[model samples]
Target chain A: MNVFVIGIGLIGGSMVKDLRSLYDDIKIFGLDVNKAHAEKALSLGLIDAQTDYDELKKADVVIVSIPVDVQLEVLPKVLDHIDDDTVVMDVGSTKLKVCNVVKDHPKRRNFLATHPIAGTEFSGPEAAINGLFKGKTNIICEVEKTAFKLQEKALKIFADLGMRIRYMDPVAHDKHIAYVSHLSHISSFMLGKTVIEKEKNERDIFDMAGSGFESTVRLAKSSPAMWTPIFKQNKENVIETLEEYIMNLEHFKQLMIDDNFEKIFEEMQDTNHIKEILNGIIVNA
Target chain B: MNVFVIGIGLIGGSMVKDLRSLYDDIKIFGLDVNKAHAEKALSLGLIDAQTDYDELKKADVVIVSIPVDVQLEVLPKVLDHIDDDTVVMDVGSTKLKVCNVVKDHPKRRNFLATHPIAGTEFSGPEAAINGLFKGKTNIICEVEKTAFKLQEKALKIFADLGMRIRYMDPVAHDKHIAYVSHLSHISSFMLGKTVIEKEKNERDIFDMAGSGFESTVRLAKSSPAMWTPIFKQNKENVIETLEEYIMNLEHFKQLMIDDNFEKIFEEMQDTNHIKEILNGIIVNA
Candidate 1:
């Protein structure tokens, strides 16, 4: 099988790594707008060879793993160049915009929109892991729109990589993900900004940061190039999540101002149920 | 040497776990306002026996690891019972208030104000782990106010547990800690509250939450009984940090409203420096 992975960064590179170990006959090709990243992917053995759009015609699978904004511009071109039977899939964070963009495309049936809920604070090809998707949920958006055979092919690959799949409409995926994923990155980044601004002496933060601070601010290190586009495409939903988040923060502050620690204790006690909910998740790091 | 642990919870229990392994002749006793916790600690071998304040005079060292509010009430009383040579140390999150509470006490010279910057989300005797303080920072405040021999006694224990000692004034310790430690807890708890309120269908959150959400919200699982008092005692600094955090969130929300994704990108890029700074410290999960 011929696998063409475009924009070979963390997600794309990780998929190909899993594919290489899963199948001996598979030949993987990678492409990146950044020449350095593609070269790094090549030297890192993440891909068999670097290829161009023209070679996509022979590809059995084309994985679009770039920033969501770029996915808008590049995905259609990728569809135009791929073979009739080629199964194209995108691993972008936001699904609604990408799904809407290819809704009426000539080869819409060949494209499968998937959001694999997995990642670390690092990025680029070097950040790829061997089993990045193992036991992680992969939300498949508008699966019925894709060709049945292509869905089967992708499902087989996901199964082989030990991924669990859930089907959802692109709109719901974006809305719910705004709460679970997008909002987390924003909250983390903002927390980092607030602390960095307050602690002029970096030594203080270094000396005082505990596991709680490290865990809470971990996502602040995420790639801006990747997350900025996600927030842009899912603006409405992201804004809603942020508004509610800001309101909760403001309300909590008011409770502090009112010296209503009894209420504060109850609020945190209620939220502590999150522990049980989170127990179901398998965090990579 | 006889060591008395005033509250046999995560911090005090873990300390005795280390002390038990670090010395053969030292006898450890524990007391808790909650009878069951002291019994559980004794059963778990975190303490050699359960004892009350009547045994404090026999205490060569007294470690107070209760909530900050409770510490204000109990620390002076604990001082009243301990011998002049008995070095009393606290592992509370907020230092200034605790320091002030015992500032003019007759046994002030025997007390060492210390905040061990280490913990997991879980609490209670069961949450105690051996080597919990290994390579973590332990902030010692008002060190000069502590008798030199008492400081040596506390410092020896810290060294034996492989903890790095940092001397900070109580004012600076509380202020700096509000930004790095207390603020992270608020951000995380509010993040959990926001997501829980939005995703009424908890299944959606369970399915969608990735490593990012899990990391950012991990602290939300912390015991409310432990945190509410810390916030109450450190109200001013905690409120200041919250104001700055809320302002940053509002500013980021404005950036999203204006479609100023470029600025959003830059903001995250600058905050990415946290990763480098965090590398200097060890976080035991």
Candidate 2:
């Protein structure tokens, strides 16, 4: 099988690395707008060749792993070049916009929209590693739109990578992802901004930051080029989640200001349910 | 020298374990309102004996590692009971209120108000581990109020545990801590609450939650009993930080709504300063 991955950043690079190890006969080709990333991916042996759009026509599988905004522009073009036998998939965070953009395409049935719920804040091909998708959930949206054989091919590839699959509508995927993923990025970025603004002395942040701050702010280091479009693509859901988040923060703030210890204590205790929820997911899954 | 730790929970228990491994002749006594916690600490060898508060008088050093609200109520009494030679210190998050409450006490000179910039979301004696404080910062406030000899002794002990010491006024400590630590807890708790509220299906959250959600919401698992009074004590600073955070989120929301990709991208790019700041602090300190 010939696999071509565009935008050899973290996710794309990691996919190539993990897949190449599993299928030695897989001929991997890389395409990235950033020449440095393409060169790094080659040096790192993430792919067998650095190819262009024309080369995509020969691919048995094509993976578009660019920023969400770029994915909207590049995905259609990649789909246009690939034959009916080619299985095209995208690993973008927001699904609705991409799915809608390609809804009427002649080869739409050959494409699958998936989001492997796995990533570190780090980006680019150098950040890729094997086993990233292992034991993690991969959400596939609008599966009914894809041809049965193509869907089987995509499912087999993901299952071979040790991923559990779930099906959902693109719109539902965007909404759930806004709450679980995009909002986290915004919260973390804002936190980093808030602390930086208040604690002008960067040294103080370093001296004071513990594991809590580190973990909470880890996503702040995420690539802006990658995330800016995700928030833009899922603006409505992001806004709703942000409003609820802000209101929750305000409510807790007011409770604090009033020194209503009883209410504050109760609210925190309720939220502590997250412990059981997280533990259950981690231990059982 | 004999050391007595009041409240053998996460912080206190970890301190006893770390200190015992360092000092061969030091006798450590444990006390916890939770009798199970005291017995567990004894069994874990975190303490030589499970003793009573009346025995505090014989302690060469008495460490009060209790909840902030409880510390305000019990620290004074502990100070009253300790011998003139006993160095009494409380490791609490908010320092201003506790420092002010103990300022006029007759035994004020024997007490040191310290905040160790170290902890995980997990609490209780079982969470205790060796070397929890190594390479972490220990903030000491109102040192002038502490007897010079007692202050020296406290510094020596923290140094022995491999902690870097920083001195600041109680007011500044509380204000800075509210932004750095307390604000993070609220952010995490509310993030968890918002997701739980929006995604009623816990299974959806379990499947959708990646490392980003996990890291951003990790502190939601913290002890409410430990954090409620912290917000209550540092209400003003907490309110100010929350307002700034909410304002930033609102601005980001507007940017997303407007599709002002340039502004959104720039904002996140700027916050990327965290990489440099955090890395610098980690490398230098």
Candidate 3:
């Protein structure tokens, strides 16, 4: 099988590593707008060669693994160049915009809109590792719109990579993902900003940070280029979730101000349900 | 030296395990309100025996590692019973309340109030592990009130355990910790609550939680009993920090609602300072 991957950053690079490990005979071609990242991916042996969108016609599968903003811009162009038999997919975090943009494409049936629910705080080719997607869920949005054979091929590939596939409408995917994923990134980034703004002494943060703070702030290190578009693409859902999150924080703050120990304790205990929810998911770390 | 640890849960049990490895000949006694926890600590070899509060008087050093509310209730009584030569210390997240409670004690000089900025979401004797405190900061509050010899003895123990010592006033410690530590816990717990409440299907969370959501919500699994009191004791500071956190989230939400891409992108980029601060700390996992 031949796979042509664009972006060649963390997710794209990691997919190359994991896929190559699974099928040594597979040919992987990398593409990136950043020349340094493309060269780094090649030197890291993440791909057989650096290729252009024009060469995507020969690929058995072409993956748009770039930042969400770029994915919207380049996905249709890449699809236009791919052969009718080739399967096209994207691993962008936001799906509604990308799905709508490519809805009227001539070969729209060949494209499978997916958001593989897996990643680390790190980015770029150097951050890629084998088994990055193992046991993680992959949300396939607007799957019914894709050609039956192409959808089957994409599902098989994800299955081979040890991913559990979940189907949803593009709008639903964006809304739920905003609550579960995008909002987390924003919360972490702002928390990091608040701490830095208030605690100007970096030494104090380094000295005082425990595992709790480290884990909570981990996503703050994620690529701004990647997340900014996601927040923009899923703006409505993100806004709704962020409003609820702020309201919850405000209510908790009022409880604390009132010295309402009973209420605070009850709130924390109620939220502790995350233990059970988290236990169900396999943490990649 | 003889060391007695009360409340053999996560922090206390970890302390015992780490201290035992540092001081081979040290005589250690464990005590807990929960008999099963004490028994488990003993079985795990975290201490030489499951002992009583009275046993603390015989020890050269006593560590009251319990919940903040319990610490405030018990630490002063523990001080009353300890020998003049014995150094007593309580390792609780909030220090101001505990310090003020024991301020007028006859043996106030024998007590050293410290907060070791290290922990995991999991609690109980089973969660204890060796080297949990290594390379972490041990914040000592109101050190001037502690006897010079007692402070020296506590410093040696922390040094032996490979922890860095930092000094702060109890009031300042509570304030800074509210932002850095307490707010992280509250944010995580509330995030978990908001998502769990929004997504009626718990299975959605299990299916879609990526590394980012997992890291941000990790502290939601913390023991409610342990954290409830810390929030209560540091209510004023926690409320202030929570207000700031909510205000920041609200501002970000407005930007998202208005589709202010530039502002949102800039905000996230600004928060990337966490990468530098985190780089300075040793993240265990």
Candidate 4:
């Protein structure tokens, strides 16, 4: 099996790491626009060799793991080169734009739109780790649009990688992801900004920040080059989540101003149900 | 050494858990307004026995780990009962109010104001775990106000527990804590609220939420009984941090509306410095 992984960053590099250990006959190729990242991934033993789009035609499977904005330009070209039996899948965070970009393509049936909800705050090829997708949810957007044979091939790969699959429409995937993923990054980034603006003494933040603050602000360390495009692609839904989040913060502040400790206490008590919800995630994950 | 844990909850329970392992001569006592919690702590071996305020006169060290509002009411009474040699320390998140309330007390020299920057989302005696304070920061406020001998006793305990100590004025501690601690809770709770409100289907959150969302919203599961008092006690500083946080969110939203991806990218890029800052915390932690 000839497999090509485009954009050899955390996601793509990690996928190949798992794939190499899972299969013996497979030859994994890394295709990155950044030559340094490709070399780094190769040196890290994340791939068999480095290749580009010209050789994509030989790929039995092409995994598109670039930033969402870049996927808009690159995915269609990827589909243009693959064989009729070849399967192409994208692991972008936002799904609607990419799904729409290839909705009317000649080989539309060969492509799968997926988002494997797994990653750390760090980025780049060096950040990749084995088993990143294991026990993590991989949302498949518009899976029915892909050819049955191609779908089966992708599903086998995901199964081998230990990913739980959930299917949803592209629009709903984008909206739901805005709430679960995109909004988290924004809230975290803004929280970091607010703290940095106030605590000019970085030493104070280091000394004073507890585990709660560390966990909450961890996402602020994500790569902007990757996230800016996700926020752009899912602008409407991201803005909606942001507005609701801002309003919620404002309402809590008002409760504080009114000296409504009773109400403030009630609000936190109500949100405590997230504990039970997150427990299920941990078990499933 | 006789030690009395006045709250027998996560913090107090945890303190005794470590203290018990470190000192063979120490006999730990639990005192709680809730009889069940005191009994639970006794059953869990978090305390050697259950005791009350009348028994406080015998305590060599009284660790107050209750809500800040309750501390305002119960702390002075605690000081009145302790011996001149006994050290009464309150581990509430807020410091200024508690410090002022005991400022003129007859046994003020026996009181120590400290906030140990450690804990999980869970609360109560069962939530207590050994080594919870290991390598964590303990902020001691108004140390100069305490007697030198009592300070040595408290600092020794902190050091023995593997906690790094830092001294600060109560006013400055409250203000700095608002940004790093209080504001993170508000942001996390509000993020959980925003998502819970939008995703009426709880399963959506359970399935769609990734590690980032989980970490960002983890504090939403914290005990309101504990946090409400902390926010109320540090009202002015918490409010100031909230206003700045809300402003930053509003600004980010406007940038989204204006399609200013450049500025959004730059904003996150600038905040990426939090990575280095947080690395220091992880190292020191």
Candidate 5:
């Protein structure tokens, strides 16, 4: 009944909260490269104790909750240190590289590749709060590769956390994620950059930024340390999605330049279907 | 005192809520080209009464809250009907065109061109709520042209609504708003379009759209009826900003294709400053 969470940031710390709430007998341990985050998680009562690499062997379950590049670095090590009965899982943004990194490991059957699609723009342990995963989707890739017993344990945990699980191939998961998630970060980050570069008046930006600007640029606040590797690992799919996204912007911009207000209106009216689609995405409190 | 609110959409109806709370013995009249919206405003108590074109003359002050295209069509007429003592202010997204259209009118001094940087993605009377402008910025343009006495009354109204006012020239207002407001809608509308075109699985879009995608594309839900005229009125500025935005995206895409991870990371890190900037923009509850 022991769970050791590696790199305890927003996702890891939030997961630890839900796990403890679900199982009274479970003891949770956390390890973070960020000493400040580790201390904060402890002060926030997010973990039972701070464990190290040496004590990582004592856990029945190990969750790799770090950036993708770091996950590629430490996941094999975690699998090597754990016992045969231990269940190892990772919640990384990009899955293809991580899945391939451990594809030939002897203990790969005990490993699970998952991405729980939830988080705010903020990062680190202080950003963690209860119910981050509630009613969110958890994408499990190559679930068939995992041992049946360990998969059952992970599924039970997600169910207890109030999540709906969707199974997909690792490649498909990364591609769709590039379109739905990574492109948004890039679009948002660049939007912030373009406006910042032109609008020299900082006070004016602050004064005139409506909720729409706030929402559009919110992801620009995401952690650079976390995102750099994600963009690197999923480079091809990310590039393809970026091209399509840029082309769409260019097309819309051309319409604006042509003073084709009617066409622009029609295109935007077509895109308004996202309202109906997003309603299913956002669960109200 | 009397205040006549034309259009009766999100901005107009929300303003009515605040005016009632901030003023005593002030009668508010609502008008809309759409009968259903006018009726909805009345039922929601957003307006004291549904006013007609004939009744617009009885106002001591008038708020011409409508779409920009309609503002161009009807603003002069509203000015023609109001007395010299009445202050006719507009809450349109664009300023230059509206300011230009009425520049030579005999009652020009009676009209004040203002753009309040406030609103949610949803529109119409039902979308109206209390305190939409509280702690938000209100941009008053061409103040020199507005009568000194009338400017005093308008300033008092903005202050009573818990807004901090910033004044700029009409041309400057449209240019800055093109970058800070209208450009955001274009970015968001296209982002939604790009992602929607790629992911045919509506259920997948529903499941995969995290708060990041939701935040980035939130403006896609905005009413086309309202935004069409905004782009048309601010055509040159919107086109300029849109071109810059598209170029930024193209540059980012090239870096991604070149696998220039370091440059991409640095760019995102720089834009991360927006997080700090946005804190000043959003007023927390």
Candidate 6:
């Protein structure tokens, strides 16, 4: 089987790493707009061959793992390039935009919109490693839109990688992810920005950063090229979530201003439920 | 030598765990307002015995690991209760307030203001684990205020636990910590609150939380009992940092609302410098 992985960065490179090692018979190919990433992926043994989008014609499975903005433009093209029998899937973060774009396409049955809930703050092919998706949640939005055979094939791959698959509508996927994923990124990024803006001395940051600060700001190191698109693609949900986040922050600030430590303490106590929710996740780290 | 550990929660419990294991001669005693915690600390062997504030006279070393607000009210009393030869120290997050309160005390030389930059999101005795302070930074504020013998004693203990001690002025320590530590907690609590409020479904949070979300929100699980006091004690610096965090969030939100993804991307790119600083620290996770 020939597997074509597009945008061979962290997600795509990771998929190739796992899939190639899992299936000895699979001949994996890589396609990335960044020539250096394709070269890196090939050299790192993430793929058997470096190929172009035109070569999508030869793939038995095509994995689109680029930024959502690029996926918006490239997914349909990749779908159109592949034959009906081929299974096309995306590992994009935001699903609604990509699913909506390809939903009307005649070859929609061949495509599956998946958001694998796993990643580190780092990015690019160099940052990729094996077992990145192991034991993590993989959300397959609009799975019913996919053909049965292709879905089974995708399921087999996900199973081999030790992912727990969940199904949801693209609308729900977008909204909920804005809360769980995108908003966290925004909060972290802004935190790093705010700290940098306030501290002035990077040396102090290096000195004073505790595990808590490091953990809270870890996602601020994520690839802007990747997340910017996600934030923009899921603008409304992200905006709505960010507004709520800001309001919560502002209210907490007021509590501090008013010296209402009791209320502030109560608020965080309620949010401590996040511990239970987080415990449910299988961290790839 | 005797060690009296006040507030038998994460910090004090962890300190006792390490101190007892490291020093066979050190007879550790515990005092906590929460009886269950003191009982649990004794049961877990975190302390040799559960004692009370009145027992301060019997202690060779008094370790105050309570919340900062309580520390303000209790520290002077503990100092008065302990003999002049006893080394009294605090492991509170905010040092300036605590240090200021004891600056003019007759036994000020007996007191050491310190903050160990180590913790798990979880709290209380059960959340306390051995080696929480290993290879982490420990901030010692107003070191000059401590007697030479006591400083040597505390430094030896920190060194025994493999802590890299950084001496800081109490004011500078509190301010820098506000940006690095306290701000992270607020951002995380607010992020968790916003997500919980918006998602309105616990199961969805459990299903959708990625490692990024989990890391960013991890500190939200911290004990409000512990943090509320720190926020209240470090109000000015925290509010300043929180305001900066809010402004940054609002600006990012505006960028997203305007579809100015390019600026947002640039902003995150700039903040990615956090990676360099984070990489400088050893993450115990």
Reference-based TM-score of each model: 0.98, 0.98, 0.96, 0.99, 0.97, 0.96
- DockQ of each model vs. true complex: 0.79, 0.79, 0.73, 0.91, 0.77, 0.73
Clashing pairs in 2: A9-A124, A10-A124
What is the two-chain DockQ of model 6? Answer: 0.73
Residues B1-285, candidate 4, lDDT per residue (tens digit)?
999999999999999999999998999988899899988998999998888788999999999999999989999988878777899999999999999999999889999999999999999999999999999999999899999999999999999999999999999999999999999999999998888888889889878999999999999999999999999999999999999999999999999999999999999999999999999999998
> Candidate 4: DockQ?
0.91
Root-mean-square deviation (CA) per prediction = 1.5, 1.4, 1.9, 0.8, 1.6, 2.0
Model 1: per-residue Cα lDDT over A113-199, one tens digit each: 999998888899999999999999999999999999999999999999888898999999999999999999999999999999988
Question: What DockQ would you assign to candidate 1?
Answer: 0.79
Model 6 alpha-carbon miss at residue A76, Å = 2.2
Q: What is the C-alpha lDDT of each candidate?
A: 0.92, 0.89, 0.87, 0.94, 0.89, 0.87
> Tens-digit lDDT track for model 2 on A139-250?
9999999999999998989988889998999889999999999989999999999999999987788877777888888899999999988888888999999999999988
Model 5 bad stretches (over 4 Å)? A283-285, B283-285
Per residue, candidate 4 scores C-alpha lDDT tens digits across A56-141 of 88999999999999999999999998899999999999999999999999989999999999999989999999999999989999
Candidate 1 vs candidate 4: the lDDT winner is 4
Residues B132-187, candidate 3: write the lDDT tens digits: 88888999988999999988899998988888888999887888888789989988
- Residues B1-285 of candidate 6: C-alpha lDDT, one tens digit per residue: 899999888888888888888887889998889999888888888888988777889888888988788889899999889987899989988887888899899999999888888888878888888888888888898788789998998899889988888888988998899999999998988888888887777778878887888889889888898888888888999899988888888898888878897898899899998887787775422
- Each candidate's fnat, listed in order, reads 0.92, 0.80, 0.80, 0.92, 0.81, 0.92
- Model 3 deviation from the true structure expressed as Cα RMSD, one decimal place: 1.9
Tens-place lDDT per residue, model 5, A68-87, is 99888899998888888889
Expressed as tens digits, the lDDT of each residue in A1-285 for candidate 3 is 999999888888998888888886799998899999999999999999999877988999888899888888898899889999999999998888999899999999999999999889889999998888888889999888999999988888899888988898888888899999988888898888778888988777877778788889899998888888888888788888988988888888777778887887888888888887887876532
Candidate 1 Cα misplacement greater than 4 A, ranges? A283-285, B282-285
Q: Largest TM-score belongs to which candidate?
A: 4
Q: Weakest 10 consecutive residues, lDDT, candidate 5 chain A?
A: A276-285
Query: Candidate 3 docking category?
Result: medium
Ten contiguous residues with the weakest lDDT in model 3 chain A: A276-285
Worst lDDT 10-window in candidate 5 chain B: B276-285
